[model samples]
Target: MRLSRYFLPVTKETPADAQIVSHKLMLRAGLVRQTAAGIYAWLPLGLKVLTRIEQIVREEQDRAGAIELLMPTIQSADLWRQSGRYDAYGPEMLRILDRHQREMLYGPTNEEMITLLFKDGARSYRDLPRTLYHIQWKFRDEVRPRFGVMRGREFLMKDAYSFDLDEEGLKQSYEAMFVAYLRTFARMGLQAVPVRAPTGPIGGNLSHEFHILADTGESALFYDAAIDEVTREELLSADASTITRLTDLYAMEEEEHAKVETCPVPAERLRTRRGIEVGHIFAFGTKYSASMGLSVQTKEGGQVHPHMGSYGIGVSRLMGAIIEASHDENGIIWPESVAPFQVGLINMRADDAGCAEAADRLYERLREAGIETLYDDRDERGGAKFATMDVIGLPWQLIVGPKGLEKGVVELKNRATGEREELSVESALARLVG
Candidate 1:
């Protein structure tokens, strides 16, 4: 993508309303614009990052044996009523009246709806276990929504529902998702720790919220330092017992840990940090199924409610979380795994015909080699180009200038480390693609 042709409306001044680092950076970087209170219109650059994060979540979900599907943003209130939560859900539920005077809502979550759908189709124990997921927008009427997309009223989410014949089966399915969550966050350059939490509205006996530690995070968290050592590969291939051992690491969000007067992990091994909640999972047995009459035929020819679980990842919030967890004074230092563009090409002397031509050729080569590249072809000063590229934060910066062309080379800079090296055009291209 060429900067001159792009719609990025980057600003030199930070907005006073943005309180957090992510929110401020997002605005300054031109990633999004606030359309209403707690609601945002994701600009092109922001959408690309959000899409990348969603795809990673989807890939990890698929690897864990979850099938994908789509669910509507608006749902009939009758479905929530069946599960006995229509009134209990509170004002956060965006209640509305349909054309026929029927109660409808912009769904805050889809537990009741998913239960009703599965009940109508699958009837036997043969359909013993199934995990279905969808990536869609959900609305919650937060009285005070702030912090940009981190706490937006309308946001994209990846919610998965699991069904099993018994409690034991439900646990196994839940563990699969647990492992998948670890892999998913790691792939996006985050070390999100799973912390036990109270199942507030979802109403489950067992629940965990995955949190990424950041000084500006909303949730205060306590955990064993060892939890940080677990890798994506280890979690991805772990058995149920191996995944279960994660709970033994002694981690809890503020609400859960506040109940315990004494800490379990000892002073030395214990670690405390402010964390952003990015994902959550719950295994709520028979809550919705029993209420909605979503039962399957057992082997003994009796109808029984299946044990179930729900897993959720804040797809839109992750972009903010990533920025919070991975930024410097200049701007966001995006990880290559989820960066909007892998490389940024800056025409440092765009007014110079020679520099512009060389930069254009390099951009073509990078694109032809299938590298995700952004070309800054704008006729701007070198310092302005440099600052803009730094704010957007691509993994690498390819600098083209009249001086560099005379030296028979281009300058390459690493975004994260601020390291620079000059090399031949061929060497730079190889470094970029290879």
Candidate 2:
């Protein structure tokens, strides 16, 4: 993509309303714009990053044996009523009325809708074990929505529902999702720690929240130091035992940690840090199935309520979480897997025909090599181009200037490490492409 043709509206001044690092950086980087309080219109760059994160979540869900299907943003309030949660779910749910005076709502979560859908379709024990997922927008009426997308009222989410015939089957499905969540966050260059959490309104005896470590995170975490030893490589291939090993170690949120009279972990081994919640998993068993009259005939000719579990990953909030965990003083340091573009091709001397020509040819070569590159061919000063590239935080910046071209080399700068190396045009292409 060419910067001159792009719609990035970057600004040097930070928005006074943005209190958090992610929110401030997001605005300065031109990733999103606030249309209303807590509601944002994702600009092109923000959409690209969001799409990349969504795809990663989708792939990991698929690998865990979950099937994908999209659900609507608006749902009949009758569904929530059937599940006995209409009155229980508070003001967060945006209840509405249609022209016909029928009750409806913008769904905050899909437990009720998914339960009704599954109830209508599955009739026999043979359909007992199924995991269905969808990536869609969800709305919640937050009283004080702030911190950009981190606590946005409208956001994208990946929610999956799992139905099983028995408690044992439900456990298997829950564990599968738990491992998949670990792999998903790791792929995006995050180390997510799973800690036991209250079921809250979702209503489940078993629940876990996945949080990424960050200094500016909202949740304070107390965990064993060993949890940090689990590497990304191990998480990508982690299994059920991985859950056993990690959960066995002590970990808790600030509220939960305060309840304990005596700490189990050694003082030296206990680590305290802040974390941002990105995903949550719950095994609610018959909570919805029993309340909603969802049942299937057993092979032995008996009626039984299917056990259910819901898994959620905040698809949009992850952008803010990633930025909170990864950014530096300059701007966001995007992980390669979720970066909008892998490389920023800067024409340091756009007025120079040689520099522009070199940048254009290199951009074409990058595209041909399947490397996502953003070429800055705008008629701007070298310093401005460099600043723009740094603010957007592409993983790499390829500097094409007349002096470097004359030297038969282009400068390649690593965004994360701030390391720059001069390489021949061929060498730079090989390095980036590889």
Candidate 3:
């Protein structure tokens, strides 16, 4: 993308209402714009990051054998009524009345709708186990939504539903998502710890919340450092035994941990930190199925309700969470896997035809080499371009200046490390492409 043509409306002044670093930085970087009290319009840059995060979540879900299917944003209120939750869900569910006076709602979750689908589609035991997922926009009308996308009223999410014939099958399905969530967060360069959590409105005895530790996070957490040692690949290949290892660890959110009278782990191993909630998994066996009368004929010729589970990863919220977890004073330091663009190509002398020609050639070569590069070809001052590139925080930056062009050298910068080196243009391209 060329800065001259791009729609990045960056600002020098920070908004007074942006309380957190991520919220302020997002505005300054031109990632998002506040359209309402708790809603935002994702600009081009923000959309790119959101798209990349959603794709990573999809790949991890697919790897765990969960099938993808999109659901509607507006749901029939009758669906909630069928599950006996219409009145119980409260104001968070944006209930509405259609033109014909039919009760409707912008869905906050899809547990009831998914149950109805499973009930109608799987009438026999042959379709015993299945995991279905969807990535869509969800709305929860918070009375006081704050902190930008971190607590937005309208946001994107990946929600998956698992159906199983028996308790054992449900456990297996939950385990698959449990591990998949770990890998998903880790791939985006986050260290998330899974802590036992209350089922809340979902109504399940088994639930876990994945929290990524950050100083400015909302959730106060108590956990062991061992949770950080596991790798993404290890979790990707995890199994039943992996569950045993994970469950044995002592970890909980501050609210739950504070209620405990005694601690199991040694005092030396205890650590307390604040973290952002990025993902959640629940195994609510028969919660929706039994309430909705979703049943299938057993092999023994008996009708039985299928066990159920639901997994969710906050897709849009992750953009804010990642920024919270990884950034410096300059701006966002995006992880390579989730970065919108891998390289930022700057034309230090955009007005100089010779420098512009060199930059143009380099941008083409970088794009041709399969690198996602953002070219700053605007006729602006060097400092302005540098500031924009720094704020966007692409992993690597190549600066083409008139002075360096005379020496047949361009400067390559490491955004994360703030290291710069003048090297031959050929050398810079080789280092990035190869």
Clashes of each: 0, 0, 0
lDDT of 2 by residue, 132-195 (tens): 9999999999999999999999999999999999999999999999999999999999999999
* Per-residue lDDT of candidate 3, residues 92-198 (tens digit): 89998999999999999999988887777998889989999999999999999999999999999999999999999999999999988877887898888888899
lDDT of 1 at 304: 92
lDDT ranking, best first: 2, 1, 3
The global C-alpha lDDT for each of the candidates, from Candidate 1 onward, is 0.91, 0.95, 0.91
- lDDT, model 1, position 190: 86
TM-score of each: 0.98, 0.99, 0.97
TM-score between candidate 3 and the true structure = 0.97
Top lDDT model: 2
Which parts of model 2 are misplaced by more than 4 Å?
Answer: none
Q: Which is superior by lDDT, 2 or 3?
A: 2
Clashes (candidate 2): 0
- In angstroms, how far off is 53's CA in candidate 2? 0.1
